[model samples]
Target: MLKTLYKGFILSYLLITISCTTNQNSSDLIQAIDNRQTDKALRIIDQLDNLNEQDSLGLSPMHWAAKRALPQITKALIKKGCNLNITDVHGYTPLNYAIKADNAEIINLMLKNQAVVYKNGLSNLSDGPFVDWTEKGLYAYYLKHDSISSKSFLLGKFINQNTRYFKGWNGDTTTYTITDNKIPAWEFKTQEPIFVLGDIHGQYDRMVKNLQAHGVIDKHLKWSWGKGHLVFVGDIFDRGNKVTEALWLIYKLEQEADKTGGKVHMSFGNHELMVLNKDNRYIANDYKNLCNNLGLEYNTLFHSNSVLGEWLRSKNSMTKINDILFVHGGISQKQIDSGMSTQEINELVRQYLISGSSPKNQDKLNQILKSFGPFWYRGYFMDRSQYKKITEQELISILEALKVSRVVVGHTENDELSALYNGKVIDVNIPLAEDSIPNQALLIKYGKFFRLTEDGNKTLLN
Candidate 1:
């Protein structure tokens, strides 16, 4: 017992000594940074030969540079190959420190240097802060900078499409409005032709190419499908850099589709929900740099006030067209049992999304957010790697409960578009944005399924 106690004491003493030595080495660098002696700091950092080493406070020199908004030092640390995504003791990244300093330039530099943007690591904005900024501060900044008149700036940067502002009241009653959104209902009982595309994942060029090849859109991205309805089965964000370009194209097409009697519907995917809620782990670094440089939070790009953002929020994750149901991730029996009606489920989901808590049925909402929601349920296709896979009988049960013939979904990454459960469940997220696969979509015409390729040809699905 005495020997064991001595050993423990020696180990503790050694750890303390090592920690003290590290702190001593880091102290000079921190002092130089606090004293604003950049040259001395840089010299001390070099002498220490620990560009990425954390101090007693778990803050590296890179963190200090970022907190100070010193772009030059940040760049130097990045060139020295520091761990740009390293989180400090407070769960703050270098990007977060820069954003806290309100140094957009340094934030941009860190983003360019491949700093992390997951959660609130970039903007120090999420939840209450996110809601507050999007509501009051952003437009105030626009007014302060005299940029309310630039329509392109407003739409592209602020995610809004507005030309004028009017505070007039109608007979002393205040009113709010959604402008010029004229899409049809979420669920359509129409027997009309439907073209269903999977996740685009920021692949603008590939999306354009596929749409052109299928004659769905003209070279200018105008709708050419006439009365044929087109649906995107969730996940239009993250993993690639051309998200803004793709979103603008979709926005333009929605208008053209409406004018031509066609329609466009974008369902919500898990990734979409994650980003809207300020979780950006799957986002690309280029997107991070772009948003930071433009002084745009990822939050602002998809708030309730934004055009596409509002439209997305108003959309249902699951929609049934004719007899075929479309969703992002596949559904399960638990989700089917959660609510009595489709409208009920949709309302519950949208409500939970806005408020972050379920008002009435907390149990149902929690299940939906977990393994069996319309946006997250993946049991139909994810059978091998996952602990749980919804059985074939369960899939049929869910479909029967929902009164749908088949469930088409796009969340699981597949090498090829797959039709599982004997044609009851179809997985179509080929990730054209990431894999550069030949553009493919599922076409349902008069209740028959076919794979529509880029050659404008349709192969019958057996």
Candidate 2:
């Protein structure tokens, strides 16, 4: 009996020792995977048989490899029969990591092993890193395909799958025929006037109020006033709780107008470009929250490839109707003298507007910025005399070359209502402050001369 008991004790001891050793080896392999030591991880994985050993964080070696984006290590672990469906602490499976990392080879391997694509798991809100990886993977997949239809489909899928937190404004779905001619026939009619709306800064309530006052919106949010040829002078975002709502509403209106032979002309604004560049960090928290609610990481929806950003980039800096020139900011003489045609200037504006935070080429970007700066200048407008002081007759020469009686702009905020400068330019930034009398927007009727007045009243220019 004594001998038997001693033998039993020895067997228990051996079993414990083996278990400890196995656990230690598994931990070492996990550490290798975590450190992205792909070869070492592979070698360690090869020594294991069960492949079910969990790391300190309870992640399997395969999960570790996938999180680290070590494709080779993942492949080796797969060869060792690592479960492709094994999820980490955050509920992200190995395939999730592979997709997020843009590791197509590893993704293919996991998919071949029957990895799931859409699984309802624990929320990834706290797992910022993993969420980032996932977005990157989706973006990469779209990039790889590179077809407009494919891209649109993939983006819709991504939004549908992820962005359920906030209400999305789907622009009016009506398809409008693009007028193939130079200018639409409706633009020439004097009786049908076009109303130019200044920067809206996401004040949706104010926008609705102004539009309603101008007979643009009815009580039911329907278009009822003017010819519907509303020129929105950009800066539709930042500084308000309703930017998304405003954008969606405007997008719908734009589409509606287009369908009815009306139009919504937009000029690129600096704030839109600032957000596009990600330089001005003081973003509206509501907008940020909207992105988070949509399951998009911060900066994800406003990046270089963002739909809004791309659309802004494609807009013309200025529009010429008859003898009048409409630009968000006035252009300088140098742009005209560079032997650039109107089409070339428009293309240049597009390039500057689209080149986000870190431009692909610095020197090329600088050249573009210098030329596009005229239509994007704010400081120069603060001191008109400084234009001559800095550029030394260059500004005047450019203005003369453009040859319009007056350049209409909306960048400088004027407290004294509207300010006419040099008898050649107009600054129509309406002050929306409570202490000040409400200012007005300038409306130039197609066949009639220029006029300015308060929101509800009109005064003809003599």
Candidate 3:
């Protein structure tokens, strides 16, 4: 009895020892792959019994190897009996990671290994990561075959603003088209009434009703506010779906408004910046599938090659109409210290999006991408204690330095339009997704400011 007990205890101890060693080896393997220390990684990987072990995020060694395009490491794992068909928490296989890396060589290698992938580029919201759209499409049928299931979004299936329908996909076409012409803007010196609306947040009905009531759009959703400057101060994507519908409407209005000497502008919002940088948490699935069909990520969909990407990338984080500065998020003193003029800032941002964010301008780019940058500054609205506090004089000084009488911003949501810093800072970010009531817009005629509601009523903010 004593000898039997000793043997069982020794066996249990060996199993625990092996488990601990294997876990450590798996972590070390991942680091070596990421650090390009292939030699050390190979040493550690040889000690592992399980090659398909996932991290807390459900990414295995194979996923990392594929993302890094380490062909040798990938092959070694395959030889060691790693499952190529295993999906991560987001349902992305190694094939998806390879597609994101844009490594055609790795993709071919995976194909050679008989790798299978998810269908339709679809994943349940409750599942893993949203479609990992890099400059390339999602899993399977990418540039492989026509008549793919992903093309369903490209048809006339999408609902647009509850009034119009959009035909997304066409069989055998290089570019898809919407049936309407419209587009997105802001002001000039000493001229038309400048209309600034705050965050749309995919509430199409609220946007249209407010615009139509204010004579911005007719019942048909055409640009009716002729020669008027209309601006969406940012946060037009995410939360509710219909982002594609909202964006298309803005695009169509931009074209129509330009024809009649009017302007439609979308200032850079943080949400837009986030999506442009590839955070797809709030991204609509239909949008993702469409992005897949085009062999592009959500960001690259509006890349320099695509007209929509060009237009969106060309938009400024901050704009000046006469003197009042309009930005999606407020600008800080730090943004000014970057020593970039508004035009220069816009150019820099455009350059960053078109070209990859490289090392040379990385510092400047990092500063701009920070929370305090123009499209993300909350110092002006948040209680100075929590974020950063500014005296009224300090606020005026900041505006004066930029040569603006007042500043208009969206992002800091309030129950209604608000005038802070004695009207020097006008926050137009109303709660669009929450309130059923149609919202108001900030109207500037000459130098005076007023809140214009959807009921044709006006409230003096001065």
Candidates 2 and 3 compared by TM-score, better number: 3
User: What are the RMSDs of all candidates, in order?
Assistant: 16.7, 10.6, 13.9
Model 3, 301-402: lDDT tens digits are: 443544355556767677787888888878788777777677766767767876868888888888787876888778886655335766788787788788
lDDT agreement with native, every candidate: 0.68, 0.55, 0.70
* Model 1 vs. true fold: TM: 0.63
**C-alpha root-mean-square deviation, candidate 3:** 13.9
Better candidate number, 1 or 3, judged by TM-score: 1
* Residue runs of model 3 more than 4 Å from their true location after superposition: 1-187, 284-304, 384-387, 436-438
Candidate 2 lDDT at 21 equals 72
Clashing pairs in 2: 100-133, 333-398
Candidate 1 vs 2: which has more lDDT: 1
Model 2: residue 88 alpha-carbon error in angstroms: 12
* Per-residue alpha-carbon lDDT of candidate 1 for residues 380-457, written as tens digits (9 for 90 to 100): 766544337778887778888888878899988776676887888888888675545667888888778888777677
Instruction: List candidate 1 stretches off by more than 4 Å.
Output: 1-98, 102-178, 181-184, 292-296, 358-361, 384-387, 434-436
Best-fitting candidate, measured by lDDT? 3
